[model samples]
Target: MTRMKELRKKKGFSQVRMQMLTGIDQSDYSKIETGKRNMSFEQCRRIALALETSMDYLAGLTDQDTPYPRTK
Candidate 1:
């Protein structure tokens, strides 16, 4: 599975549920998890917030899932 799918499953969120949390359509979110589609910066930010993880982690830049402390 891709990193996105792995993390989503780890969070116990289905594509439908992830859609609800991130405002991304289920099909679109599915594509993202499957690596068939790319996410925009805003989408990435929303997904990171929904998953409580770093954008870098979601982008496969790092293995660590812990997010940085919020600045605001």
Candidate 2:
């Protein structure tokens, strides 16, 4: 499974829940998960936040799933 999908499942979130959390449509989220579509930077940021993971992890740049501390 893609890192995004895996993280989503690990968080116990469905695509519909993802839409609610990320403002991404379920169909489009599905495509993104399946690698049939690409997500914008904003979308990626939202997904990472919703999934409580780092964008670097989602991009396979790092194996660490823990997100970095956020600042205001």
Candidate 3:
């Protein structure tokens, strides 16, 4: 499974719930998750926030699941 899908499932969030959280349409989110579409930087940021994970982890840049510290 893609890291995004894995994290979303780990958080017990459905695609509908993801839409509610990230303002991304469920169908579009599904496409993003299934690799049928690409997410923009803003979308990635919103999704990372909603999933409580870091973009690095989502992008496979890091194996750590923890989010990085946020700056003010």
On lDDT, the candidate that comes out on top is 3
Error of 1 at 24 (Å): 0.3
Tens digits of per-residue lDDT, candidate 2, 5-65, equal: 8888878989999999999999999999999998888998999999998889888899999
Give residue 59's lDDT in candidate 2 (0 to 100).
82
The TM-score that candidate 2 achieves is: 0.94
Clashes of 2: 0
Model 2 stretches with alpha carbons more than 4 Å out = none
Give each model a TM-score.
0.93, 0.94, 0.95
Higher lDDT: candidate 1 or 2?
2
For 28-57, candidate 3 gives per-residue lDDT tens digits of 999999999999999999999999989888
- Candidate 1 TM-score, C-alpha based: 0.93
Clashes of each: 0, 0, 0
Between prediction 2 and prediction 3, the one with superior TM-score is 3
Give residue 26's error in model 3 in angstroms. Answer: 0.3
Ten contiguous residues minimizing lDDT sum, candidate 1: 1-10
lDDT of 1: 0.89
Q: How many Å off is the CA of 62 in candidate 2?
A: 0.5
lDDT on C-alpha atoms for all candidate structures: 0.89, 0.91, 0.93
